[model samples]
Target: MNRLTVRAAIHVAAIFAIYLSVAMLIPAAVDLFYDNDDWQAFAFSAVLMGGLALAVALATQGRPPPVSTRFGFLLVNMLWMTLAVAGAVPFMISSLDLSLTDAVFESVSGITTTGSTVISGLDQAPPGILMWRSLLSFMGGLGVIALGLFLLPFLNIGGVSYFKIESSDIEDRPFERFQIFTLSLIGIYSTLVFTCALCYAMAGMNGFDAVNHAMSTVATGGFSTHDSSFGYYADNMAILWTGIVFMLIGGLPFSIMILFVLRGHVDALRDPQIRVYGGYCLVFSLVIAIYLTVANGTPFLQAVTHSAFNLISIITTSGFASDDYSLWGPFAVVCFFVATFLGGCSGSTTGGIKAYRFLILFELLANGLRRLIYPNTVTPVRYGDRTIGDDMQRAVILFIAAFLVLWAITAMLLGATGLDFITALSGALTSLTNVGPGLGPIIGPAGNFSSLPNAAKWICTAAMLLGRLEILAVLVIFTPAFWVR
Candidate 1:
């Protein structure tokens, strides 16, 4: 990369860090109100991070240049890493007494909306710290959406080029259009979060819990205020059902949501990805609910409610559980494991292989089967109204291949660190998919990641970054050819 590219990347990253530092004050204010000593830690961290950001910004300030595609990849990864470290400061300095590795692991998990936690006793943790964790997820969710909708399409990463919006002559100016779209999206996201919080409060939570959960729920980040997650409110059907509604909302495509809000139409309901995502959730929830009611002897009403909440949570990559579905049965266990990979719609806050890609894959397989039956027939795969091009198909297929390969490799590495087969495999898969809990005793729904080895924590942290960036964006930066130009 040229000096101009490097300078531009650093300049933009510094601005991001500086903006993130401002978020620290929210936690600091909370700490002060709660009379917790953690306020000083956040205040100190804010000053330190802000100083570093300002120094870089000042030193790199000059005639600004557009970020090249190569530099955009580098900047995206570097910005996340830098902000994660910056976000970890309070955890390391506070009474939480987390080691540096653990702190970074927690921070990365929060920022990636992975919902995995290395800390227990969350009910007793300081309000500021809890708020900070939720805020990290909220901010991270916004960044993920922006990257998916804007930068990823521009970079032609992950078959997202088809998502690029065309501009008419009246909207010919690129940056202005981007500004308007971003503002509109942010408004919609904020409104959803506010509405969710209000519903949670009405359903029976304290104001603090309601706000914190609203942030997590809207972000699909799933960092609950208690160890038992939504189970802490098991008897509160209203709260559980509220969570289900917002979690599904969080997983839906933001672009569609924005359009629905602006045009006052039902166009979003007709989206192919939305239809597939809803159908998947409905089918999986019913399967699990039936199993729970008939086999486990759970009451039918409770069975459906828990089943829907937990299924939606996992499918959306939200990671909240109203009960230990892991204990429902071996069949339920397998179903939840599979659901981890079938994430929500693209351009949403959720993670894993998105619904859009799966829709494409199914079309590809069906077309291939038809070709075998009738030789010399040309079968074109279609997604909604558009014909799938060869380039788009290849990109989607390559992404799935890379995702599975990386999951296997990460699992093996975790196993080498002495985790059991189940824990290793599930941990690797969950981390890579940005899903929170794994299966097995160690990292399962009932357990936390606090006991993992330092090496394992670092590996999981890297996996979170890799998954959040859609794998290829980070992997490409490491390739020799990426550096050659």
Candidate 2:
């Protein structure tokens, strides 16, 4: 990337930092309304972060610089890290008195929509911190939708180029320009959050909890207001059903949602990835529900409800838990662990090896087996109506391989910090997948990450960033070729 592009990316990040600082005031006001002194922490953070961000933005001000594909990766990494630091400031100075490591861990988790937290006593925590967490998730979710739709396809990260072609080929595109499309995206996103919030309120959550959960649910973020998460409302079938519906929506492709909502393109909902994602959710939910009914002897309807909620939460990487599936025997534990890696649709907020990649991988495997049988078989791998390209196949295979390698490496690092096997393994998987709650006792559904060593927290934080960026985007920057002119 050119010097001009670097400056432009920094400028954009600075402006984002300013917006983040302003957002902090919402929580600050909440704290003030609740008569909590944490408002002071937010005030100090907003002023400090906003002032520095303003200076940087002013220094880099100029005509819009040309954006290169290389610069897209840079801008994304820079923006996320900058906003995470900006988000951490309040936590550092808040009444909770978190260490810098803990604050950054919470902040990174929120911005990545990872939802892994270090703080405990969330049921009675200050409103400011809680609001800040949800806001970060909300913003992070929006930012990632834009990233997946606009940047990843153009950058051709992990076979996402297929989406760019499909989107561009549409004769009646939703919006003619990027700015207009962004506005539509935001409008649709805000509408979803609003609807979810209203449903939560009608289901008996107070306004604050409803709004916070609405943000988290729509983001597929899973940052609950209470330590028990959805368990706090376990008996509230209304709320649980509401969450199930919205979380399913959160897991589907936002592009399809936009087209269906804005352009009345109902056929867009039939996209192959959508069908496959739905199928995965259905199959996993049913399997778990059956286990709950037969083995655990839970009531059939109750088992289905809890199983659907928790399984969809895991597959979507939403991480909300109504019951601890970890205690549901070895089979259930294995199922949940596998579901952690089955993230939702590619253009959505959820993370992990996305449903589309799995689709691609399966096609590749079948094609390979066919070639072995027929020797010169002429079968072209197909996804929906389109034939899969060799480039996309290679990208998908490499991405999955890299993901597993990184997960193993991260687990090793965590184990080195004295964590047990389950904690280290699931911690690595959860962080890389941006799925909150590991499988073990410490960081499981019932526990937070407060007890993890500082080094382990940092490792998880780095893994969260890597996972959020889809691994390759950040890893590519480390290559010698990336820096060459």
Candidate 3:
């Protein structure tokens, strides 16, 4: 590792420590008034984070001005993992009597915006603890946007090479442009949160609950202040529709959004990703709605609303549900299983295979077919107006392959730990993707990860890290070549 890499890692560590300190204050104050057990957890977490952060900064003070690329990549990935470990401190130290594994699992889930929770009975849980959960979702959502437009572009990670393509040739994008776009993204993200919070409050939720749910909802994370998920207000169609709208907004590309903000236009309707993502929600909602009405005997209007909410929630990898589709007829099961891979647009907070990849994959397959029909023809895959080269397609393919391999491995390993097939499989996929709620009795949409076996919890932790790091970051660090001078 070079001096620069050491400095960057230390800088990230220090920032985390600062945030942890600020976050702990709330719980600490809550402990004073409410005498909640989570207060102890936050306090302990703060101390651990601060001490380690100080040590890292001090030790790396004399490091060089620049580090090797390998070390830089490794440092970034390792820093996030380390932060997750520290973030778990509060949970483990709390009154819940959580094991280290469960704490880490919850931490990873939150920081990754995966929304998976090992805690249960949120209604009775300390408000401080629940607020921390929402804070994680908020930070993680913004953190993802920052990483996408800034860090990921810098690292050329996860097919972020597209950003470079979009940038100017002279140092690529101007710093001024980047700043404007970033600020607009923050505004857009925050505005959605604000709007949703207002609607939720008007829809009978308390201010705190409304804000928390809004953040998680916009982030496409399913961390609920209530145990029943969004179903707690099943009678409120306005809130459900409000959630659907913001969830869609949350899943769109920030870069594309800044155009309207910067240029004084409202052309969100024209964006290809927006159209594709919208079309996806519509089609699936229609199919699932019809199936529910016909096969499950649900009322047509209720089926349409429920199906739309659930389809958007899952396809965007949001994980929220007003009704658990698992209890629906077989058609609902099939619909959900297929929807797992239809992630939101790139540069959005939602996680999964991502819609663009599937688009490119199908385009590539179609090109191959056209070429087969005309032996001497040359065909290329394109996304929007840009022609996608082989390197980009290869990167997406590798990403999908690596993602699935990790999911399968984690599921198999969890199954070996005594989880049934559906539970293990869904748990592995959902946890890895940072999507809350899995399948089956133990960790399904109606269940929480709180009751999972310790061994299973640890596996979920690893999967969450792997998924959030986009698979390659963690894997690259482990290769012997990555460690070389």
Q: CA lDDT, every prediction? A: 0.88, 0.90, 0.76
Ranking by TM-score: 2, 1, 3
Ranking of candidates on lDDT, top first? 2, 1, 3
State the lDDT of candidate 2 residue by residue for 154-259, as single tens digits.
7767745657544432345657787877788899999999999999999999999999999999998889999999999999989999999999999887877887
In model 2, which range of ten residues has the least summed lDDT?
Answer: 165-174
Candidate 3 deviant stretches above 4 angstroms: 1-4, 29-44, 62-64, 165-181, 265-269
Residue-level lDDT for 175 in candidate 3: 35
Candidate 2 CA-lDDT value: 0.90
lDDT of 1 by residue, 1-485 (tens): 67787788888889898998899999999999999999998899899999999999999988776657897788888888888988898899887978999899989999999999999999999989999999999998898888877778667677455465211111243335667888988999999899999999999999999999999999999899999999999999999999999999988877767666775547546878888999999999999999998998989889999999999999999999888887889999999999999888878999989888998899999998988998799978888876878877887898999999999999999999999999999999999999899998889989989999999989999999999998989999889887775
Q: What is the lDDT of residue 29 in candidate 2?
A: 98
Best by TM-score: 2
What's the count of clashing pairs in each model shown?
0, 0, 3
Q: Residue 331 CA error for candidate 3 (Å)?
A: 1.1
lDDT of 1 at 117: 96
- Please state the error at residue 102 of candidate 1 in Å: 0.8
